[model samples]
Target: MPTESFDERFTGPTLNQDLWVDHYLPQWSEPARSRARYDFTTDGLRLRIDADQMPWRDADGSFRVSNLQTGTFSGAVGTTRGTHRHRLDGLLVETPQVTRRLWTPSSGELEVVVSASADPTCMLAIWLVGFEESGPEDSGELCVTELFGDRIGPLSSTVRVGIKAHHDPRLTDDVRDIELPIDATKPHAYGVRWSGDGVDFTVDGQVIMSSPQQLAYEQQLMIDLFEFPATEQREPRNYPKTAMVHSVAGTSAS
Candidate 1:
């Protein structure tokens, strides 16, 4: 195991303010269509998405669901701190004018024991993103774990991992939907090790997907337990599906 860098076990009654920033946010800008549906319990960090919950309208005039990240970002529409652009490369990238704070990690291994929501309209994801002050080509992402609802089967579910190019020439927009041995809705440890030229993903210590591309830039951790209503159809199998995170631990050799 790599030497300990940063670890959060969610043992307290609330989230550690020093390690996390609530929402994607500055509340003045990207307000939710509704309110946060989370509980930081001794059992873990519980995140929920309710179909009946209405989204809160933002100043941008869009209603959004609950969202949060381990890092902080805020700025204007086109303002940048360093070299990153104010907009995306036609897809999703950082929004600079509204972004301010970012905490990038050194080389490390990040592991989280989590249970996903059963709703197909939602997904539970843990990933890494470039601070992107370096520019858009450097705005690649390492999706350590993305558990989508539609991908879940009766016995098991497929989790996608690896790099999402996002206009980065150095990355291969490659991702694999690897079938896990257990039901994703049950608590399981999903991990990613960033070593040399590869980012290996594992489930309960078993290697599932290995991406050959290792990003050398500074990256920050991001956690997403959200519902994309656009991804849903008919009535949900269940309402207010919650994603439970037992812990998020990071260790580094540096």
Candidate 2:
């Protein structure tokens, strides 16, 4: 087994503020709007998106999200510099973030014990994204696991795992979706063992996918629960949609 650097069980009366920031891309959306709606219970961290919750970034679209990140850093406000800038048009920072790096490992084995909500409009994802402190080209992502509720079945689900190049030119997108015999609404361990050689994606201690592309930059963990807007076929309801995280553990490469 790899030597563990940290293990967070969420056995808390409150969240460990020193290790996590309960917001999703606050630099682009502002803290009040990006703040996550979550709580800790015997089941661990329960991230939820209520029916009445406002969209994360109104300019982006009508989607709401609750998330936690191990680190955050960005340039001055109004500057187009921040982690995970998805649009090519550029994203101005709404608020400058004080650099925080609770855990940023260059190469590691990171895992999360998690379960997704059954609502088709919701999605649960755990990923490691570049801190982008070294350079904008470092903003790649290693998607540990991504499960959309619509892809989930009673006894099987389509799990997405791989690398996202984003702004990182050295990397190419290699994401893939594989059908697995498992109930996504139930607890499962999703993980990734990454190094300069490549990355291996795993589920329930078993390797599900492997890639030859290398991502050697420092990366931070990001856990998110998203709720898409109501479509013509699916209307919004008052029921709360939630994703539960039983634990998160990581072992840095020696």
- Among the numbered candidates, top lDDT falls to 2
Which lDDT value does model 2 have at 170? 95
Cα deviation at 44, candidate 1, in Å, is: 0.4
lDDT of 2 by residue, 156-254 (tens): 999999999999999999999999999999999999999878899999999999998988988879999999866623334654789999999998784
**Cα lDDT, all candidates:** 0.66, 0.88
lDDT of 1 by residue, 1-254 (tens): 21236677878677676666566433233334434567777678888766565544323332334555555443445334322222433322233333433346546788889988767777888877776656656767778899987887669899888878765788888888887667898888888887566788888888888877867765667676766666325364556668888888876554
Candidate 1 residues lying further than 4 Å off, grouped into runs, are 1-4, 25-29, 33-36, 51-64, 74-103, 230-239
Candidate that would win on TM-score: 2
